[model samples]
Target: MWQGLLAFVALAAMAGCGEQNGPEAQMAQGQAPNVKIAQPLAQDVTEWDEYTGRIEAVSSVDVRARVSGYLEKVNFKAGEKVKKGDLLFLIDPKPFKAQLNYAEAELERARAKHELAKNDLERAKRLFRAKAISEEEHDARSKGLREAVAAVQSAEANVYTARLNLDYTKVRAPIDGRIGRELITEGNLVNGGGADATRLTFIVSTDPVYVYVDADERSVLKYRRLGQHIGAGQTPVRLAVADEDDFPHQGTLDYISPREDTATGTVTLRGVFPNTDDLLSPGFFARMRVRGSTPYPAILLPDRAIATDQAQRFVWVVNQDNQVEYRPVTLGAHIGQSRVIKEGVKPEEWVVIEGLQKLRPGIKVNPERLSLAAPY
Candidate 1:
């Protein structure tokens, strides 16, 4: 029984040895040298950042009626671009005029009473000196005169307030901007106390418009470290309308927010685009591009050349013998369709942009001469 067991173990060992020494196994080991590889390449890439920006007017205001009254007429067209002091809407001034007249009449009455009180006080002063009237009567008359003066002042203030209400009947454009649709039509009562009575509409400044965008703090910090001030005159912004194939107009940076947005944790940047022809409007989404200082002699690669290995980024670089080697690279911000290489590469090196799926380190490459084609 022992001899049969030993014979079975010997037969298994011999079969394993034969399989290891087979011709098929030897051929598979030598095939690693034939695999293709890529070399590092150079490219002129401009780094760009894409942020979802909202088009906003530099100045936006809501027009509201001050006095509670019926909207008599709308003077301007809805959605019309209006200038400052342009007539927007007119509320019925009949009520305001009546109140003004009442106030003015009261003021006149108070003035007449004040004149009478003054004359009476003067008479009391003269009579007191002659001892014809008691000092108490003189004091009372003097007090009455003072009270009459105060009443006159109060009436004057009321008249001024009434005039202000009358002026409120005419809703005028406070700023030069494009007016929105009127919220309340003629004969509709606008909220006197608040903007409820009539929504005169919104007016937003379209000329030298604002583009509000956000950038990650890290990217902003990186930009700051480069010692570039993204300010007006220094920073030129180019904008592309949603449907336009190309960016037609350029703008300047207007204002940068004092603090970063806490909710999104990004800095809010606003750029003012000149709208000479009034082509750009508020609430229209447009693609904004900002130029940064191009650090000349930057190393770059096509977008697909680099890949993440586990958690680290690495690229395949080919040597003179066409042998593939793995290289870890430090990546900077994306520039256009390519990437900016901060480290681990040099100029004039070929990089693998395509055919990277079937590639590994230490494999030989049969490099097919590729035509240097300009990117579309």
Candidate 2:
């Protein structure tokens, strides 16, 4: 009876092991992994080529005195907004005023001399006509009158120049802009009107700023082929400063270099933007993008959906049988979180956006349908 019992127990243990390794148990433990899948977003999209660029003022000027003088007063506060023609600095006007006074006095003396010569010439002309004076004497008086007229004109020019010098003593802003700190303070002697002129300050126009960028030769050729010419203002551009995530500023292509730089093989391009709020400033680093292609129908997938195998980018697509298929894709520019699909994926096919690590080609998946329009 003990021998029979031992054999029966061994058989029961073998039966239990078989049940544990049965197909039902395997099916229960190894169900297909759930994945989120959605059809590619289809829209008319324009590809934007991105570039790093620098912000520049539309107009920039260095403030300097037009006349040599002792600086009397710095009219503007350091780093203030000033309008065109606003007084920026004042030079000592006493010396210029004295020179102007002397010029006026000389003009008056020249006028008196001219009158005396004119009267003498008139008397000589009458005597010569009445045969009361020699012709030589009358000619000398006429010559004196001509010399006097020239002297008077010279004096008048001197007076005008003196006035101009006096006006130059008051330095004014040449353009509307935010001014830099005063470089030369009051009581300092400032030289003017040469290469060595003292720089008083600087001003850069704030509104309608410029952004300059360099584009590769291929990009420039593409733009030309699209019928866009230099300074056409037809090509639209968007800009974002270093602190911004999105391009909030809108501008137009204003300039393109006539020749490409031989060393870099790139062409310089400029865009003009209106800065009403004064947020954009010169010398700031910014990211700018231009519309590279015309609007066309494109299939878009979230950047997360894209996977890389060596150099090839691909995504997993779910077919009508709910089996994951490997699809290689060609990508274009990125639009927000989505990438443009130049080829490979179709608009109607669903692509796996989640559970990518658990997927294999031809594997069945529990697909949860998602709307591409909704946030991923």
Candidate 3:
């Protein structure tokens, strides 16, 4: 019985030894492991710097009255498009009209007085030449005529002012834009003129909207070095609204601040985009990006192939000998699922894209070559 048990144990040991020599066990004993490898894709690419920005109207105005009076009529609908010089509101024109009439009547009275003074002066001049009247009396008459002439000139000025005020009673649009709702409704007295004038509504131009963003000084300098001129419309930009996942709006850089904000160390930049469809509105939050660098040749690799070790980024490279090598790299902007390799990797070198867990430095690999035309 003991000899039979010993034979069984011996057979079990022999079976275990035979299993160790199979395919799986051979891999652990220095047989090459299979991995996917591909050379980096080389192409001309541009880098874009992203920023949070705000959409604004190219032209904005706070509508107000130039003459003070009770609002008589609101001529425009709330949030409607208006043309320049379009009648927007009507003040109490009755009072202004009456004032204008009185001024005209006064002007006529002054003209009559002026005519009488002219006749008097002519007679006084004749009397002085003939010595029929004393010189002092003639001089007094001449001075009286001069005073009348001054009064007439003053009355003419009053008439001009009255006509100007009458025209102001009919409020008109100052520019072409969309108007807001009336804040001072009909029958409400609105103060006009001076600093305390009441605000009736607001208007903002609809087409060709503006977007403002603040960029760091370093970035601004870089853009200047790249030959992006302010207001030249050469530099291109892109924008996306809050709900959008990708930038769909295209615009051009139209303005850059002449001075920087010392406190924040950032300069303001403005981009202009056409809003003929009225999709963009002032005060909307948006994400914008500016072309940071011109197109240049660069090497790119799949983002998944790169691994982070503490603070450093690295990747596994498969050389011509089919041996894995660890390499550190400098990275640039991310394009889709691929990363731009700024340094450390060459265009012709093959990088491991899969089976990274089975890789170690100096270990042989059975690499399956793949094309990097499309990212994986």
Model 3 — which ten-residue stretch has the worst lDDT?
224-233
Clashes of each: 15, 0, 0
| Top-lDDT structure, candidate number | 2
- TM per candidate comes to 0.71, 0.89, 0.84
Root-mean-square deviation per candidate: 7.2, 4.8, 4.3
| Every candidate's lDDT | 0.75, 0.90, 0.88
**lDDT, residue 199, candidate 3:** 90
Q: What ranking of all candidate models by lDDT puts the best one first? A: 2, 3, 1
lDDT of 2 by residue, 213-239 (tens): 999999987776654543366788999
Which sections of candidate 3 miss by over 4 Å? 1-26, 29-36, 228-233, 320-323, 354-358, 362-370, 373-376
Model 2, position 349, has a per-residue lDDT of 92
lDDT of 1 by residue, 1-376 (tens): 9999999999999998887665445434654323323344455555555555768787899887788878899888878889999888888999889999999999999999999999999999999999999999999999999999999999999999999999988888999988888888888878775535445688998888888888778866654543354443456667887887556678765555668889989887666788878888888887887655553556666677788889888777777776667888899866655577788766555555666765677666655544333222
